[model samples]
Target: MDACSPVLVVGALLLVLLGASAPTVSAARAFFVFGDSLVDNGNNNYLMTTARADAPPYGIDFPTHMPTGRFSNGLNIPDIISTSPACLLSHLGEYLGAEPALPYLSPYMRGENLLVGANFASAGVGILNDTGVQFVNIIRIAQQLQNFQDYQRRLAAYIGEDAARERVSQSLVLITLGGNDFVNNYYLVPFSARSQQFEIHDYVPFIISEYKKVLARLYELGARRVIVTGTGMIGCVPAELALHSLDGSCAPDLTRAADLFNPQLERMLTELNGEVGHDDVFIAANTNRVSFDFMFNPQQYGFATAKIACCGQGPYNGIGLCTPASNVCANRDVYAYWDAFHPTERANRIIVANFMHGTTDHISPMNLSTILAMDNTRN
Candidate 1:
């Protein structure tokens, strides 16, 4: 019964050669990512936006020890979910033979690299086109979808049309949006245009309706299995604490926004699944609840503090951008927040761990490990 014994290996190969499906034998699955800085790897590096993270103290903890435009002290959520060995899901990473999807806009994403899939995420972008207008140049969701289409075309040119379609259909997609719509657009300034147009109660459904369209478009584009994450505890982030909290408490208004939005988001995903006639086409990751575990109880998660960001200045080190002059923590492992807005690599690992094996309360329908197992069996 040795796991890698000759008999098992030969049997697996024979099953594959005979076109017989086996749970243990499956083709390598491609991973496609689309969304904001939370999951952005380095797409912002190629853009001219102020949302860039290509500087010192940013990727000091990354393997290369060089900033890679990830809005974290080290790896971001997508990095851990896809290919990080340091994550608790490293076994799953090995099982999927996961590789970090290159930024779609990167010059290196050509030829055989296209077969590995691409990351279309950009910092500061949101579900709404106007969510991050302050950032001069960034890829909005519309453009990201268009880029995905272009990617598929290029892929078709390389591998034949039918194979390209198959690859995309079997891919795993991750989309993280909505947070910016609140923080950067609606509540960015007093009497902000979005806020002026719609009250908080009205805005949530507006964005959710728009989000459904985006998800539908994704399905139309051949994305069968997508992991859609709700906004994190936005009110508890260091930035909101600095701006709104007077005595080190989560901001009430922004927290209220998250409360209103996340449930609706989950409902929308459920309805979308029903429309697709399957229970597992879209899996909603309850990021707010998972993040609350560490943000409210940093000690339980081996963190010294969650309110104080590892990089930044002013109250909670949550004011201003994480520039070279800003205070930087010597050990990123003990802090929960990286900057005012992003999470440390360690925190990202915890969030992704839930995505892999958490219960329905955290990941609805089924977790990623379950989805992978089912998909592998089906294939």
Candidate 2:
């Protein structure tokens, strides 16, 4: 062939055009969830505990109009993040393939279902083993991690070892912890055991250290992309306000606990990412900042009220758990909270929007959209 043949030039041009026209095909990424009730789908249904939410008014807003062990009146955070077209609404859902990951304990999560990943989150569980001790039979973070390992083994049995490991390494992982550590443990009583063990100053670091270990374990288990959400405005929740607020304001002590916890959580995540030699491995979502937007200014976010629960009784509707006998709101969509501690599905969607496309202030290092774009490029 000639060094500068017209035929060769034409062929090169054609090759470039063909390459430009070909669409990129990225593999469907698996999703893994690990946390507490905020993301729990139906894991608690299989367990015997007071933490269970499989009851009336819990899933009244869900597609089936039936409770599915989710704390919210409708779909929880995880559901909105990974649900199918039927549940799709947020941009994040578009990235997360069809169908939400099934609860690890669900009977249907076997064989081919393993490839879709699983949710290991359990209601009332926290970073520490004793955080939700009162809710006996719940899966603690330690057990959740163990279950993740078991899940990999089960997946390996179906798709061989190396392939399963690769699938996990390329998957997206989300973990929301620490909140229950304070609410259900350190501040459960006037002088709880944890509160007495260490001052708020000291307790924050201890939990952050404990949480570091959990994140490290996830990374070790081949989780390359992980979203670590900080504690939200826990003090602003109806339950806290009812218990500790004197003038219908957020409890100062609990608010201080959250302020102290979230920043430290971000710092720990930053250190973890630096240790891994990658900036995008562990993205920290400032749940407090985004949540405060709707919690403080409900009307701005289209909510009628954030102080009262749609399904509770006492002050702020924050006294007890939402049950069949509670005063249910006429319009669940207008209420920021579904019960004493959980957010309504509408509130959850707003939170997810920030996670998917918020600034560095709301999502440190980079947002979920950036992570998705980068991962897609890599794939």
Candidate 3:
């Protein structure tokens, strides 16, 4: 918590990640994170799956210098957002206090911890129930929603139904799904079940339709202000580059899949908001475009390498998980990716900046700052 600490001093400059801050409005905020490996903090650690990060070199750059199942070399996207000054949660009123939401599966995450918020994300999950079946015990989107309902029941027991409803409505909710649908499902097995059932053109729409149900259910469960993120630049990740791009260029096929997914996601979110009679309720964060900025031009973003992951082996250093035997980068700040599929903590920080206050091009309709401003008025 030292302001003069190395990370803090650097954070001051990185705070410019979103360009500029919006008009200020202080209020109490509770943050809830739901997603795949991208936004998962430590939820997957408690699950039985190969899609985990609770091992050496995973959180090498974290403050604890130990793996926290974040799928990054340090703090992941959610952690950066929670600690950033541009985020309203960091400036929460003293009466509300501050604590990163606990993972829903954590045995220690109970009592007062539930009041702060809870993360229900499990690594390898997607919007579809069958998305990450290869990972065996991963929590699919429907199961996560069920857990959310369970959390609500526990919350109502502690603070009554009305208060819990208000807490959920007023609280900040972030959901980062869809990426796994591409990486782990449609493309996991060549001519996979999903791919054989429908081509890319039809598959994207199918995924969107299924995703619509999940968002509708979230709304039904009382998540008024939600930040739904699009999938990142899938083709640009080290895994794709290594497997499909021998020349270090992005795999065009996967990138096309992402292109197909994000725009429809935006339209679907807009339609959902309209159906609910609130324009700002479902905010879309264009993660694909934001990540493409850095992935396409790593040096421009201060990264020495974006194609080669800081860990793993074989081509692009992205063959598998980041273990002790993996080739570890001495300075993760210069790399865009941490492992085969996820970004380095520094890259995640930049993405979080865009989510905090980037314009419509980065975050559609409005950004997190605007959402916070609207919530401030109500709270």
lDDT of each: 0.86, 0.85, 0.81
How many clashes does each candidate structure show, in the order listed? 0, 0, 0
Least accurate 10 contiguous residues by lDDT in model 3: 17-26
Q: Which stretches of candidate 3 lie over 4 Å from their true place?
A: 1-27, 84-97
The superposed Cα distance between candidate 1 and the true structure at residue 325, in angstroms, equals: 1.0
Clashes of 2: 0
**lDDT, candidate 3, 213-245, per-residue tens:** 999999999898888999889988888888898
TM-score list, all predictions: 0.91, 0.91, 0.90
lDDT of 3 at 87: 34
* Per-residue lDDT of candidate 1, residues 185-236 (tens digit): 9989999998999999999999999999999999999999999999999999
For candidate 2, what is the TM-score? 0.91
Off by over 4 Å in 2: 1-26, 85-92
